[model samples]
Target: MRAELPLAAVLLTVVACQSPTAEATAGPSGVVTWAASADRMGDGIAGRSYRLVVHTSVGGTDLRIRLSNAFGDRPITFDSVYAGIQQEGAELRPGSNRRLAFGGERTVTVPAGSTVWSDPLPGRLPAATDLVVSLHSPDAGGPASGHWMALQQSYATQGDHTAEESGAAWTVPTGSWFYLDAVSVHVPAGTGAVAALGDSITDGWQSTTDLNRRWPDYLARRLQRADTAVKGVANEGIAGNKVLADNPAQSALNRLERDVLSQPGVGTVFLFQGVNDIKAHTGVTAEDLIDGYREIVERVHTAGKCVVGATVGPFKGWHEWDPAAEAVRQEVNAFIRTSGAFDAVTDFDRILRSPYDPARMLPALDGGDHIHPNDKGMQAMADAVDLTALDCDTIG
Candidate 1:
């Protein structure tokens, strides 16, 4: 006795029933828990598999990975990718390995100067866990994209062995992280992250290898246990990087968008750079460096994020130090301390400088070269950060 519905009405009803939720259609709402700024590798390797081990800062479900081809002059094809918990050297925890796909496909071709994020793997990734990502590239050539100074030991193999859980095939030990750049996890809706944009000190140059002793790493550990909503951290530092010019790596100003602003769920850009610019003797004045910093702060503010400035640490014992450079360093630190240009400031110079001689670094913290901080110094820098300042929602 019921009347028949029109075909159009029936089709519309079916479509509505099959539609995904608003959140699902919008993509995974995840925050980056770990990231390593990418740099150009000396030479690219083809037909190789990489077992990259990275530490997570926050715990959450729905894990995702980011692969970068930023410096590649040609397209790179990744045939297979997997993620798992590390049991030991090149070995994965049993029953924890899961395959990752891009757009529902196992293989994805990333165009030159582009990046791709994988579909989320459903599972809870604990904070501070060693997450191992295995990826195989069928053809990876041209300028290789990776973090050259990982300060961690990752493994590699010659063929398509990404799904293997054992270490038998992964014979080559690599200090650099290849292709992979960022890792994300779905945390509570309000959780955010901070990106440390800096140089060798921030990049863990003198920090012990495979120990996660970098200042940023220590900061991440603190964030994990704290009650603050800012629970994620990304280390965007590059060894020998400068604020105004490119030395061995891209300048902080030039790579700001690619390394800091582009990261997911980042709420603050922690600027801890400029030592190289002052010591390089490149005729870069405090005005020039300040202009560069202002530009970065403006750009990040435009993107709706806060900026936390860190004073440049003292480096009087390095071979490049001179009176002119020391004068410039002092002038720049003065501005960083009183500029009101940043939302917050951390006086790393005060933290690492010797009380006896303000121009020199504390002997206990100096990592032999007097330029980079030792592991204890790294921890001190992290401890100096006010966690509440990182949770600011207003841009400055």
Candidate 2:
């Protein structure tokens, strides 16, 4: 008699064969899922055209792709979607490319507020390459909602319903899919993983949907150029996460373990937290915040991983801004600058602050809120990181 695989077991075996373990991170031990989303209210209009840019470091022999509409109010219909390698910093022009899909077919219907991954495709990515993903719509669309994770390249297609051509090398148009998620790739062993843990800035709001402009994506490009061993980055930043409790959504401490420690093969941790903690109403004292930092540091260290701390930047217009908070900000900066707890430090304050008005934010970097950094500021944030800090030998 021959042994048999149960239905769920058969599904698991198929996923394993597609994604594989050596080229994958440790997790539920199966196919890696990818997705993205959009909304109608204030994000984009229904029936409007939109595009998505996703960066993947999964350089493997076999791969699969998925798009999401999990946030839409109605079923998202797709007309045409294009995938290819990015040429010159998200410029969706000509490059080595091909039309990708779920098992060699086109046109998919993703239910409202849901996700869809493509059947496995033979995608072989070189080290540190940026994959450009663009989508087109022929009708009024919904408010775009998707997280900025991956450490590679991403871009969005523009125009309302009749806008058609998304300015790609191709001229065809596709319907629309609200939720665009994961693009999993099969890989080999010894690949390094990136963990970008922070707040809304890292989460990517108002930064042009599908542009993939999150700072970590730039870091991914840098890492790819410098070391192929570094695979990809996992973005764990929540829109309102704070270092301490400001509110549940705005608290980084509340989600650190779930967001950072829980990620698979998190070889390095890059922290850009604490702004919300200080900006929260009735914020804690500098010493109190320091104690919180100490606790977080201990937990991260206990996980046998290295952490890079980011100093808080100037935020005079925040609700909690006051002499006491400013003083605390300086205190925290001093601690981050000198503390041996962190393996390295990235001074975002130094990168985006206005020298002309040191107390104010740099107009170019500030996203009109005088708090969150704009796309340019996000780029500066990525540039501030010393790529070598993620080197295994350096941390280990």
Candidate 3:
């Protein structure tokens, strides 16, 4: 649903001027049940049709999708767009596939650094179903707006096959999602969502692909089953992302509004970041990272949302970990636990660290990478979340 933002949020709406941040990220009247943080991919292609398969968290009618050209140097046009249920690889469930329109037009162009949402398609979607969004961009090029590490494999073809239910023509398989960023469903009144903002761990790096096993995915399932007001989940993580600096992708601080607060029905933000900044040996002190956390809490509060802070997990054997970084992690975790800066805290460090060696990750949960968590670790992180903390209005 279209949410009204305070005048100060004007600066945060980096999308097109005509489209407000709230409407672009959240549907006009529904909560964003699924979203992927958008970043610049290699480049867009003309006549490229993508059949992206994404799992839903909450069920509702009138589903909508948001397409972006946020990083393009020039305007891009999408000639045809369709949404359907995925039957299998590059194949759609017959008769479930339907067309999507933007402002009553079949064709729409999104300017550089902007996004657009499709008119809600009429139908009911069940929770946990695989929803496929297929679209063909007639004239697409320049730095494409997409997520680089989807971890889930989707399909692509050379021509406009968006309207077809067959998978015969969709030959290319891709690991990243292009253009399509956010999806929403018209949920019951007062249904809120939680957006997880972090780095690779939250981005589902070590999690199983296409299985929806990211920590956020597990949290989504939890929210769906619980009697809480929050049922939607948005994963706003990026690999190699930092909290205070913009390099691999925009820093968590920089993209907070567009990726988190702008999503409709989002009442809480889960902040689990900082390892990259510490382990990178950037001379960032514990105080520095704490300030970043404080700023995030303050901003989220200002936006009328609660913040849930997570302690940085141990990474003793990672290539970049060092004594100094470990010290910083401990100090930061101390502040997160005792400072009360956040409305709530999730002790991921306490949950994932080895009892024998606090600096190292527990062997069973280490996904072969000392820095990233395994599937079990991801589930543990999600299970550790206090679901009640996700709905600020209800909790308050």
Q: Give the poorly placed runs of model 3, Cα more than 4 Å off.
A: 1-27
> For candidate 1, lDDT tens digit of each residue in 328-382?
9999999999989999999999999999999999999999998999999999999
Tell me model 2's lDDT, rounded to 2 decimals: 0.58
**Model 2 regions more than 4 Å off:** 1-53, 61-184, 246-250, 318-320
Report the lDDT tens digits of candidate 3 across residue range 170-279.
99999999998888888789887899999999998899998989999999999888999888898989999999999889999999987888787788899999999999
What lDDT score is found at residue 344 in candidate 1?
93
Question: Residue 5 lDDT in model 2?
Answer: 24
Q: lDDT per residue, candidate 2, 115-189, as tens digits?
A: 555544443544444555555545435644444333333334444322222245333333333345555555556
State the displacement of the C-alpha of residue 105, model 3, in Å, after optimal TM-score superposition: 0.6
Residue-level lDDT for 239 in candidate 2:
62
lDDT of each: 0.87, 0.58, 0.86
Q: Please identify model 1 stretches exceeding 4 Å from their true place.
A: 1-28, 394-396
Candidate with top lDDT is 1
TM-score for predicted model 2 compared with the true structure? 0.62
Name the better of 2 and 3 by TM-score. 3
